[model samples]
Target: MNRTLEIELIDELIALKSARGLFLEEDIGHAPVERYASDDQFDTELELVFRRRPHLAAHVSELAKPGDFLRVDLAGRPVLVTRGKDGVARAFLNVCRHRGAQLVGENAGCQNRFTCPYHAWTYASSGELISAPHFASGFPDADKTQFGLTAMPTYEALGFVWVVPSPDSSLGAPFDFKNYFAPIAAEVSELDLADHVQVANDRISVAANWKIIVEGGIEAYHFKIAHRDTIAPFFEDNLSSFRSLGAHMRSIIPRVSLARLGDSPRDGWRLRDHANTLYSLFPTAQFLVQQDHVVLIVANPLAADHTELRIATLVPKSEAGDSELWMRNHAITRTTLDEDFALGESIQRGLTSGANAKLTFGRFEGALTAFNQSVADTIAAVS
Candidate 1:
């Protein structure tokens, strides 16, 4: 850890020890207050958090290579990320330089060239404007060089692709992901996420602000009440939540011992006695790291009251070959996510009733408070 973070961590540790299950007044009251979801000012905040952040997107090892490509929505714009013939990753606005049509509609695939659906405008993996439907006709002034797809700024590190929508955006700004995550990158790096591959993925839309849904995953305070049937039996009421870079939070739930049950043995199942780790990366990414696998939830907010949550289950390359574990984990993952989203959507409907203006964060919920505070700071700074 850096000296600055070390000092902050020391203070946090001291506070944690002294308060046990409460937050300091300064940590809560001193925090800035603002609406992140319904407000128009930070409309793109979720997008920046998901796609532009270096540490968050640094989960891919390579981008450009023979037949390598990925498609992602950068905020509302369609983005096509491709590895060129020269083995360099490049990102282009998915719109064809001709007539503003989407170049690639599929989620992801390896393609040597992209062909527009409306016209036959095609582009190479390098995003070079290659061929147009008809030439030497009505439009002789068209320049292929100038018509190449709008390329976005991209960089690859730690195995993921990071993109900046504004090509000329400042790289040294405070919100620059690398700077924002400098303090906690080591902690995140310890997970060795780059070593894992996506085993399964599923998505669902919920009626809730992105942050409201994120709040569901960041604190264990609700596990006892909301997930009593599923997660409560496995965790202790006393949970530890840590605030890290970019207003991200990690929740640690010490596991319970089930071996005491009549016929249960502690042999192979002893691993369950370890802690359950939950990580919520800004602005709305949730990751749960278990002994065997890592589950990532990329929450994309579409409206003030609607969010799309994508769940990706990742496993070690070796374990990915196991069909039985994949099947079992997939089912468990789906059921758990549905349970969370069901509640989150319900809360969204409730929050709009004017019955609740501000929600209080219990001492155990300090991480959520810290995350909201960070959002407030970012919005204020941007303004």
Candidate 2:
């Protein structure tokens, strides 16, 4: 973050601590419960949001060398992302030109060529159809160029690879990656995220609406009640603040020990020392910046009440040897999130039960309100 914003956040934290209160919105916000339970709404979101947005595929570190590749499933399409010999990262449909068989099934690997097990149709790491067994008599006039994998527009920024599922007609225009990320680009750039090595990457299926999972991360109003046995003791009760970064949001939840910073000189007060900053990266990802490491939580919506949640732990390259410490950190975070996801599941069941017509967001849950508003506004504008 910039110096000015850092100081301002520090001031806000100190004042909120003194007042024993949290940042609040002007009024309560309401969202219909049907939005989470309707199959039609979920299908629309999958078509309008997931298929058109620039979804994060993998970090550059995951594809550090040429010929390195990773397979990711996005919006029901298996995407193959590879760093070619030319040192450019590219994405393509992970399917063969013939017979529609999946070309590569491994989660990740390093290889110069991929040969389809079904037909022996081979392709280079650069996505070129180099060879096909027995094409002489069966199909002598086959064009190698025309039989290559379907390509998807891929870009590397902030040390991550992002792919748009239908790039040509996404949002009815060319997706402007730079402009879309302008709000939080400089802040993320300052973190040198590319330099960090991913320590762990895992996924879990959650029985809850995607929005419920996302909403769980952007506010601290429920921490004291929802996480009483796990993380509640460490954090202050309902004490947090947030700011909207374009359509995305950034939130800060201070540790209960922040009051001790009052004894230290203001010059020595570091933001990370007293709080954790969580960045909600628009539609699919959340980045939690802690003192020693960063955690990325990605939500992939599978249905109106199902989501695949992927969590990744990233740490500085220098700390790669400290497996014990990183493991402990990862375990704690995972446990806390498991608690949150459980709550989301219960909430989803309630929504499905049709007991409530709408859900209410209080003043303290301003971050949730902002996030819901952003989603609504974006979908409305696109529709």
**Best candidate (score: lDDT):** 2
Q: For candidate 1, which ten residues in a row score worst on lDDT?
A: 28-37
lDDT of 1 by residue, 225-248 (tens): 777777677765545446555566
lDDT digits (tens) for residues 49-129 of candidate 2? 777777889998989999999999887688999999999998888989988999999999999899999989999988899
Candidate 1 ranges beyond 4 A from true positions: 1-65, 133-142, 166-177, 257-273
Judged by lDDT against the true structure, how good is candidate 1? 0.64
RMSD of 1: 5.7
TM-score attained by model 1: 0.80
Cα misplacement distance, residue 288 of candidate 1 (Å): 1.3
In TM-score terms, which candidate is top?
2
* Clash count, predicted structure 2: 0
Provide the TM-score for each candidate, comma-separated: 0.80, 0.94
* C-alpha positional error of residue 77 in candidate 1 after TM-score superposition, expressed in Å: 1.5
